[model samples]
Target: RPLLKTALLGREIVYIASIDSTNNETKKLAAAGCVEGTILLTEEQHGGRGRLSRGWFSPFGKGIWLSVVLRPRFLPQEAPKCTLMTAVAVVKAIRKVTGIPCGIKWPNDILYQGKKLVGILTEMNAEMDAINHVVIGIGINVNIASEELPPDLAALATSLQIETGQPVSRRELLTVVLYELEQAYALVNTQGFDPILEQWRQLSVTLGQKVDVIGLNNRFSGVAVDIDRDGALLVDTPAGQERVIAGDVSIRPA
Candidate 1:
């Protein structure tokens, strides 16, 4: 779109009325040699997904359901940094658009006043050491009302409209998101992950908190100290310090 000020991201967008999943479509495109920066935007996603294989709640014309195809020249080990960078970008975009404070929970969830406002899922294809492509899926609850959400999610999920007491233009938000993402991606490509990690720490709600992390077969409670260079969470447990690469983190009260 003309409103987008990014150099690469969102330059070639595939807009659809409906789809099973934007991530899935973007992967297909990436496999067929689609150029980097190609994006897929849909009004509705029938089978949207989130991190840890959880189902994302996506209703028609109520949210931003989109995925971007990227071919960054980073190794697979550095992929998690992309996810963290995206969280920072989304937080900045939300604050700029709605003037509401938002923070990122570790890994990928964006929180506003302790409730989830956005979810990001990043998937990548790689060789042993080199990444072939990455699809960053972003879903933001933009205009959904409180009552419209299921009772199970009513307590944990929120939207921009709900927080601001007015509808937000998805078009404007999407353009800003692309611009922010492009800036962050450029930072990662040029300067490295340190700047992105620093910004993420500034907007984090999980750091310096007692928390519980639930992995596939392991769980632990600790004080989240910092995120390592690889983007794994470093927690000080009763036994010792541990680095968590993948898990569901729940922040405990101070």
Candidate 2:
């Protein structure tokens, strides 16, 4: 891990040729008292998962599939800020490495030219007021061609290669990602969430747009106005302003 410039993250990495899910493996290690900043990286994931229990497509040697173990000293309610931090880090890394300027869709999806380029799923083991560990799972489609993606995902997903019209080095991209994440994590600890939130806003594509949010039992259409301190999306509806903490957000045509 010498190539990584981060002080804490990626210091101890476990690399495997294939696994069911990096997040699952990282959770197992976290429960066994693995140190914070430990990373679980796999070349292939057979049973990868996304938010809302969706399956992630991870073919062998086509993308970056990994999970990071973090032990942040923050309350359970502040966990969503970590997801925002991750989005900023990923966006910064992609822009720096591949020159593909990307934006973040609320919560944790990275997009390029309105197509998804990266997905992040953050899970935490915590109580009401305390946190034991947090696992940040990230998947970035790097070299996969557009035609190689599944038919269902062809219009919804994209890879770095497709966006930039060139191949990207996964190793270099991962290193830069880790470094950027470390920097953002440090900022959250030292400066609090305001600075990180500002960066998130600048890189966000969801704010100030009409959106439709689908929750478990309810759906609403409104204009996304702002993100609260707790990282909740504030949607301005016809009735009033609504705060959405968790849901699927889709930007609608204005």
Candidate 1 per-residue lDDT, tens place, 38-78, comes to 99999899889987677899999999999999998988888
Computed on alpha carbons, the lDDT of every model, listed in order, comes to 0.90, 0.90
Per-residue C-alpha lDDT of model 2 across residues 23-97, encoded as one tens digit per residue? 999999998999999999998999999887789999889899989999999899888888999999999999999
Candidate 1 Cα misplacement greater than 4 A, ranges: 247-254
Residue 142: error of model 2 in Å? 0.6
Alpha carbon deviation, residue 55, candidate 1 (Å): 0.4
- Please give me the total number of clashing residue pairs in predicted model 1: 0
Error of 2 at 90 (Å): 0.4
Reference-based TM-score of each model? 0.97, 0.97
User: How well does candidate 1 score on lDDT at residue 46?
Assistant: 88
Model 1 per-residue lDDT at 138:
98
lDDT value, residue 32 of candidate 1: 92
